[model samples]
Target: MPDTPHLAAQPALSIFYQLLQFRDQRRKGGGMEAIATTLTEQDMRDIAAHYATLPAPAPQTGGDAQKIARGQQIAQQQYCSSCHGAQLQGQKHVPRLSGQSHAYFVTQLRNLRSGARADMDGTMASAARSLTDEEIEAMAAYARSLP
Candidate 1:
């Protein structure tokens, strides 16, 4: 069962939770480790293949229109559209910002600003550094409004 009621709403997170459990099991150095090591290379490859085949997540379409409009303006001013698509759909290694939960999005932005997040090539860190909490909140709101 999900640890929290909200967690049950995000079924996709089960994959990450399972991965963390697998890592913890390996670290414990006992029966769990044995099970972790039992996965054949082919099995790992198949898992990766399946992940690659998963469909792209649908863009989010739920938010207050006023908040979304404000966020859009903030994103443009912040140059977020330069890296994330103009629609916040993401590109290459950059993650899609659209459809992410507002809480999760805000937390990531805060982490980036605080230097707690390890971003590729330091671009996100630099971008985040210039954001005030209000801007971060606006960005999250805007990103979650895309569809």
Candidate 2:
């Protein structure tokens, strides 16, 4: 399962921020500066907390269970869980692979493998080095099978 609450809240922060702005701007001519000053750490945390209630996303892909199995082997051998989490559902700052499109997964892996995509520390790039295109496809298939 994913940290759905955080994922859900990440996209809605703008709305909560805007509400904060409105509440803070009630005085001082409603200036942006005043609104900025009015925003407390607690206020931000409160807004972020709203999304912690969302449910996890559903599984997105099916078929070729063998490909998924092979992908699992590759992922394990590559030590992917060290960063992406044990299930590849992602952790803080890492995007979930479970429900992503296969094309997206393949493209990202290809880019990362080739250094066309930017990784925070080149870890993905290095991990992707030994992956063949077929392996990438298998990994994508496997990732889609996760919940």
Candidate lDDT values, in order? 0.62, 0.64
Single out the weakest 10-residue window by summed lDDT for candidate 1.
1-10
Write candidate 2's Cα lDDT for 1-147 as tens digits.
Answer: 221122442224433544454455531222444555666757765754565345545566555989989988988988886767678866554555665567757876887898765555567689899999999988988877877
lDDT of 1 by residue, 1-147 (tens): 111112221233333333334544522322434554666655544554464356554556756777788889988887899988888766554566776667768876887788775554678899889888887877877876775
TM-score of predicted structure 2 = 0.63
- Looking at model 1, residue 94 earns an lDDT score of 57
Show model 2 residue runs off by greater than 4 Å.
Answer: 1-54
- Runs in model 1 deviating more than 4 A are 1-62
- C-alpha positional error of residue 27 in candidate 2 after TM-score superposition, expressed in Å: 40
Candidate 1's displacement at residue 134, Å, is 1.1
CA RMSD, predictions in order? 7.1, 10.1
Error of 2 at 104 (Å): 0.6
